[model samples]
Target chain A: MFKDAWLVASKDLRIERRSRVLTNQLLPFTLVILIIFAFTFDTHPNLLVTLSPGLFWVASLFAMTIALQRSFSLEAENQARDGLLLYGLESAGIFLGKVVAIVIQSAIVELFIGFGIVILYAAPLHEVVFLALSAFTATIGISCVGVVFGAMVTGRSRDSLLPLLIFPVVAPVLLSATKAWEDYVRGKVSLGDPWLGLLVVFAIAFGAVGVLTFGSILEE
Target chain B: MKSDRAVQGLGLVAVLAIVATYILGLWITPPAAVMGNLVRLLYIHPPVAWVAYLAYGVTSVASILYLWKRTRDPRWDLIAASSAEIGVVFTALTLLTGSIWGRPTWGVWWTWDARLTTTALLFLLYVGYLALRRATPDVTQRSKRSAVAALIAFIDVPIVHQSVVWWKTLHQSATVFNASLSPKVHGEMAWTLLLGFIAFSLAYVWMLIRRYQIAVLISKRQEILLQGALDERMSTV
Candidate 1:
């Protein structure tokens, strides 16, 4: 299972590297969202700084949608999904591999968005470690949920459906991640710990669910 | 035809129960000392909310049955889909009635209160489930994907509720719209609430049967149409 996972992950990452889709498209899209938020709330810098945590996660949420779309779109061509099923690849491995690839891609966009939030909103860069850890765990939860829905919506032309499906479901992730970041930024580390813990719990629980259910989804 | 008669009988009983509930709730029950006449909405609101949760619970269980290899059946898929449709309607009513109930009670139509937020999220999640069903063109694929989605979304409900409750507590805003069952149910009001639950549950049964029948009929029609098309092509060839 681990070997199959690595093979799948490497294939996806190699495709992503060669295509440069993340750098050329999704990264800039997230930055643009950051810029738009900066302008939308340009009334005062202080307000922007206070709201940066939410804005950062909202941008990450949007980027997660695109990353999920790209992940499944890679399988849309030439019966690739059929090949995976027929070739005897472990469904759990494929599920984890896809999740890992999406997490990596989302993390890159999240890091850029984090930097953009700092530069654009003038948020103080004090809780670097807390922010990074919170963001990493939250991204895992987001990716796990996103990949499951992404696979579910494959071969369907309803582009709007993915976000509509994912946004409400992942509300807890957004709520916790945003609150954790807010607490960290406001220097209330103790308050943020529970939310961070919630993020980790969500990530693991959803990842396990994905591993258990992906085989059914893939075969069906 | 037999099942149709049963559904009709159930529908009639549901209608009668609902009407009885309305009369009891509006006139027979004494006005609440606390909420006054506004307590009338309670009969409708709580029952609708009950139906919503009940319907979703049915969907989730049916989905599990459909997904399990040993017990997989097309009827479970139909049950899941039909129950989900009913669930969405009840959820919408729950939100609407909750909002209406809140206007006078909470002094606002809506707040980020835990139950209300969780219910809204539940509504959206199932809306997505229905949309997923519509988006997938294949029957088997649709059933499988939707069943899985149903289970995932169902599992998320408690987590969403818990998180929202925690978030509310952390913020320490006094929630005006308390969702706990009133500990002080007395006399006719209790009877009326009971009637409301019974009426709604019967209504859910009637609706699920009708919706499931329609779904079966539609699929049968599609099969016939596909057969006709294939026959025509074969004749031409």
Candidate 2:
């Protein structure tokens, strides 16, 4: 399963590298969101600093949607889905592969947004270890659930439906991640543990769910 | 058809029970020490919220049945879909009635109170679940995807409640609805509340059975239509 997952992940990454969509399109899109947010907040460094944790997650969440859509759309073209299925790849592998690819893309965007927040919002960089851990666990949770819903909504004409379906369900992740980031950035290490624990639990629960259920979704 | 008759009978009983509860709650029950006549809304509000939770619970269980390999059945999918539709309606009612209850008591139509926030999120999640059902055109595919989605969405209910409770405690604001959780109501108020639960449960059964039958009929109609289309194409060839 791990080997199959790596193969699929590498294939997706190779396709992404060749197309440069993530770098050229999505990264700039995320930066544009950060800029828009800065402008919306009137670029008051103090206010921006206060709201930066939420803004960071909001940007990552939006970018996560686009990343999920791109990953699935890669298969939607040229009957590639049938190719994947006919090749006798395990659905778990396909699911993990897609999830890994999304995690990587989302993590990069998240890191770039982190830097953007530091520069644009003047957020302190003291809690580097906590921030990275929060982002890592949150990204895994988002990608696990996101890929399932992404595939669920594939071939549908209603473009906004995926976000609608995913956002409310993922509210806890947003809530916990934001709270943890806020506590960490405020230099209160103890206050961050519960939120961080919530993130880890979410990631593990959904990860198992995705693996068990992906084969059923693929068969359908 | 027999069950349809039974459902109609149950519907009549539900209406009567609801009417009784309303009358007793509004006129027979004395004003409370704190809330006064505004407590009347309590009967309908809690009952409606109960049905909403009950409906979603049914959906979740039915979804599990649909997904399990040994127990997969089309009826389970229909039950899940029907329960969800009813669940959404009741959830909307829960929000509206909750707001009405809040207005006089809390001096605001809405607040970020734990119960209210959690219930609102629950409504949106299931609304998404229903929308998902509409998006998938294939029956088998729709069943599989929605069942899984239903289970995922159900996981949020407890978490949302717990998180909101924690959030509320951290902020230390007085909760709007926690008073009702105490088993303190006595006399007519307590009886009426019990009647309210019974009435709503009956109503849920009636609506569920009716909706499930409608779903079965719709699927049958779709099958016949497909058969007719295939027959026409074959004749043309």
Best by DockQ: 1
lDDT of 2 by residue, A93-175 (tens): 99999999999989899999999999987888677988999989999998998988887886755367888888987887899
Q: Give me the TM-scores of chain B across the candidates.
A: 0.91, 0.91
- Candidate 2 lDDT over B26-73, as tens digits, reads 899898889899989878987887798789999999999998889999
Worst 10 residues of 1 chain A by lDDT: A151-160
Model 1 is docked with a DockQ of 0.78
User: In candidate 2, which residue ranges exceed 4 Å CA deviation?
Assistant: A43-45, A190-192, B159-182
Chain A accuracy as TM-score for every candidate:
0.96, 0.95
* TM-score per candidate, chains pooled: 0.93, 0.93
Model 1 / residue A39 / CA error / Å: 2.0
Candidate 1 regions exceeding 4 Å error are: A190-192, B156-183
* CAPRI tier of model 1: medium
Report every candidate's CA lDDT: 0.85, 0.86
